[model samples]
Target chain A: MKKLTTPLKVEDLKDLKAGDNVTITGYIYTARDAAHKRLVELLEEGKELPIDLEGAIIYYVGPTPAREGEPIGSAGPTTSYRMDSYTPQLLDQGLLGMIGKGKRSQEVKDKIVEKGAVYFAAIGGAAALIKKAIKSAEIVAYEDLGAEAIRKIYVEDFPVTVVNDAHGNDLYQSGRKEYLQWLKEN
Target chain B: MRQIDAGLITESVKKMVMEANYFLPEDVYSTIKEAQDKEEWQLASDILDKILQNADIAKNDQVPMCQDTGMAVVFVEMGQEVSIVNGYIEDAINQGIREGYEEGYLRKSVVGDPLNRVNTKDNTPGIIHYSIVPGDKLKITVAPKGFGSENMSRLKMLKPAEGLEGVKDFVLETVELAGPNPCPPIVVGVGIGGTMEKAAFLAKKSLMRSFDSYNENPFYADLEKELLEKINELGIGPQGFGGKTTALRVFIEYYPTHIAGLPVAVNIQCHAARHKEVVL
Candidate 1:
């Protein structure tokens, strides 16, 4: 697995092909459907975004309530396709990466290549395992959206597989081909 | 008639909700564990390992297994001979759901209005279903429904002439179309032969059945096995990344239907098929 930091460099992503397992550290922001919508609207109106998009990676998640003294609650990626409409808008703003589960639309895939952005697939439904990698978390915007609010979270060795890389490779379609081929051969 | 305090139902629901979210049921946990051995894909096997560990953490720490702790879905089998005192049964169950959600720190996911899009905040007004049976006992089953997979659920009305082939095709097609979005290694619940709504309800209800349990109908039992194999062959694998196990099982529940319409519903449930039952 490759080790990289967010606000990623072109070189950092260039060598990373689709289906390559990765462990990303450094700052990453969290946003789901509601937060993505508002962020896009802000961009359209030429208003200041809550966070700088120039070198940021976004995760689609809305965590549960944290108990007192906990860093955050069980945090996992929500499905990615729900944010498909707003993704191109965010990608245009120099967003470098996205972390979530599921397949993306063809339009989203085209934009990922055009804007030199990447999409990563975190394991869906393994929230507690993912939560252990989070070092800290704080809401950055859209707090009124409840579980759909925006939050900035720090993670260590946050595991993901590159689902869509900037050069136009797609893993969601390709992630299982090897296994299927192997089964056929055996 | 036996008198039962409504408040007792409330307390039982609260406990069940907490338990359902925190503890992965035995059937689900074991199936996932068994999948690790059978999974040929490395990534799929790795995912199964993490899923098993995630359940352990939730159980030991008393935390929700997933962030989407799920919308409370309470299924009550009410006895006709019992009398509920001091409150309505539904209200008591909702009261328990609110407490479990708030006190247990589970995420409140229900929106007050689908279009207006406001969080209900306390997660009240659980999706409660009731069936009146013969005995004087209340059997409450708390099944927290998560939308990751729920969003992928589908229903179809086919011509009676379409027959078994159509039913099989629809179920397989729904799972294929859902891909990784519903979180693979899923539990597919098939409700066939009912009217549209009843079919959908049966599909959701089938998810609450343990994976190891057999359907009384031998034909459906064999069909379930066939469909399960067909799904795994899709190679959707764990979390849709690809693997040997696309789904843990396919459950079918059927009822008598009209001569003209054959309705089948597919309710896709995530690997975290959490449910707890209690009799009061």
Candidate 2:
């Protein structure tokens, strides 16, 4: 396992490989389909974004509202493919990483390699356990969108596996291939 | 004839909604636990561990197991001998969802219109299926369905001649195409036979069955077992990391259909398979 602090630099991701477990600490932004649309639209309009994209990791999540005395409720990654269309533009804007579940389009994977970016996978249904790593969360944009609003969250030791790294390797592809090979041999 | 209060139904549904969201059903929890114990792959085992821990945290802390909280899907078995008083059952049920979402702090994930795409803000108007039975008591089952798996569901209308092989192929193909998106290890609910809509409905309904239960008919029960084996073979594994635990269970629910058509539907459900019920 490796440890990483956010606002990642290009070199910070240079050595990470697919299937490597890592724990991330620092601020990550939350956005899903609705917020991603607005962010891309803002970029198209040449308007400033509410949060900086430079060296920042985005988590594809829409956490439940926090209860009294809790930081956030059931925070976990949503499916990542829905954000594939908007991702290349974000990468161009210096978005360095994403944390979510599932596969990415080949175009997005190629873009990740081109932009020196990383895509991390958090266990999809493990929301309550993942919430423990979230120290604090506050809405950063599009509050009217409710759960789909963009929120900036501070996390400590948030566990994730490198799914797609800067080298263009995809864990979802390799892991299954390796397992199938092992099954055949054994 | 027996009379039942609609308000009582509302209260029960409200409680059921909260309970379903907060607690992982025992059948699902235990099956996951078993999967973890038997899993050989390190990564898959760890993923299963976290899922089990998440359930524990949700139950103890009284928080939702997943952030999606899901749009509530209710199944009603109304007793023919009972008359509901004070209000219509549908209104009562919607009222329950309204109050439960607010009080429980669950996310409101429903959209009022498909095209306009405005959040209903209350998660009202759940997809409800009602059936009339001969009993004097009302039975309600609250199943909160998260969209991750629901979006991956598929329905097919096959020619009668295509038969059993066609059904197996479609189910496998759906799971394969879904890949890691639906949060495997998933529960696959299959509905074979009936009309198109009925097949789809049956598939969704099969998801409500306990994981430990199999179809009553030996032929279908055997097919369910066979399908489960083939699905795990796809190596989707837990969270699609690849392993032997791709699916915890596969359920088949069937009804007689037109001789000309053989309809099949597959409803993929995430590991957080949550449902709770009450008799009134």
Candidate 3:
């Protein structure tokens, strides 16, 4: 398993491979459909973004309501593909990593290769399980958006698997192909 | 007719919300465990492990299973002989949802306007369906419908002559087209019959039944088994990584329909499958 820390760099993304387990630490940023829209709007306006994109990892999520005595509610990853349209734009601005469930679009994969970015797949539907990695979390911006608001999360050993590598390797494609072929033969 | 207090209905709903959102129903938990044991792929097994862990954390910590805690959805069965006092049953359910969501610190996922995209803020005004049955008690079940799987759900209106093969093909294609997106190893709910909307409603409602539960009709049960086998054959696997356990279960609910049309709705559910029930 790989350990990730904050202030991530392009070189930090180089060695990662599809299917490799990873434990991510440091300050991860949050985004979902609404947040993605706002981020794109900010980019279009040539304005500073809510968070820096350089060597940063964005988590696609919107958490549940927090009960008493908790930092956040079941905060599992949303599907990554929903943010496909806005990803390349952010990757162009130096976004190096993303964490969510499932696959990315071809265009997103191409950009990941060209920009040396990586996509990590977190366990979908495993919100509470994944949230345990988040030792501390606070809304950093966009509070009015509720769960979609951007939050800066301090994680410890946040487990994930590399789904799309900088080299454009996609596990979803390879993995599905392997099983489907086996199904046909048997 | 008997009178029932609105406050009681509200309390029942609140319990339903908390229980459904925070806990994994025992049947679902066991079903996942069974699937994990049966899953041959290491990656899929590990994913299933993490899902079990997620349910643990959500239950023990009183956290929601997913951050999207989903739009509050409830199915209610009321006895015709019984009557609610001081308020309409629908409004009481809305009130319960509001309180449960607020009290639980669950995300308010509902929006007031689809076009303007404004959040209702309290998660009130749940999508509630009620059926009047013979009994004195009101039975309700709450299922938090997440956007990921809900987005992938499909409804098709085919000519009656299309037959069973058409139904099976459509379902397989829906999941195939969904690919990795709906967080696979999904539970597919098939609603066949009635009008288009009824088919969709039954599909969602069928999901409320136990994952391991078989259709009462033997023929339908056989179809369920066959469908499950075929879906696993697709190799969509866990989270769409290749594997044998593409689906944990298939539940089909059908009603007699007009001779002209056969409507089938496929409602896909991720592994979370969080649901809870209360009767009073």
**What DockQ does each listed candidate score?**
0.86, 0.87, 0.75
Clashes of each: 0, 1, 5
- Top candidate on DockQ is 2
Candidate 1 lDDT by residue in tens digits, B1-280 = 9999999999999999889999999989999999999887788899899889999998999988989889899899999999999999989999999998999989999889999888889887899999999999999999999999999999999999999999999998999899989888899999998799999999999998977886899999999999999998998889888788889989999999998999999999999999999988
* Model 1 C-alpha lDDT per residue in residues A73-160, reported as the tens digit of each score: 9998899999999999888888889999999999999998887788999988888889899999988888899888788889899999
Cα lDDT tens digits, model 3, A1-186, are 789887688898899988788888899898898899999999999999878888889999888756567677778889887899999999988889899987788999999999988898888888888777887789988999988899988888988888899888898888878766765776
lDDT of 2 by residue, A79-108 (tens): 999999999999999999999999999999
- Chain A TM-scores for all candidates read 0.96, 0.98, 0.94
> Each candidate's TM vs. the true structure?
0.99, 0.99, 0.96
Which residue ranges in model 2 land beyond 4 Å of their true spot? none
Query: By TM-score, is 2 or 3 better?
Result: 2
- In candidate 3, the residue pairs with backbone N, CA or C atoms under 3 Å apart (3 or more residues apart, or in different chains) clash, namely A64-B67, A65-B105, A65-B106, A65-B107, A66-B105
> How does candidate 3 score on lDDT?
0.86
lDDT of each: 0.90, 0.94, 0.86
Residue B16 of model 3, lDDT score: 78
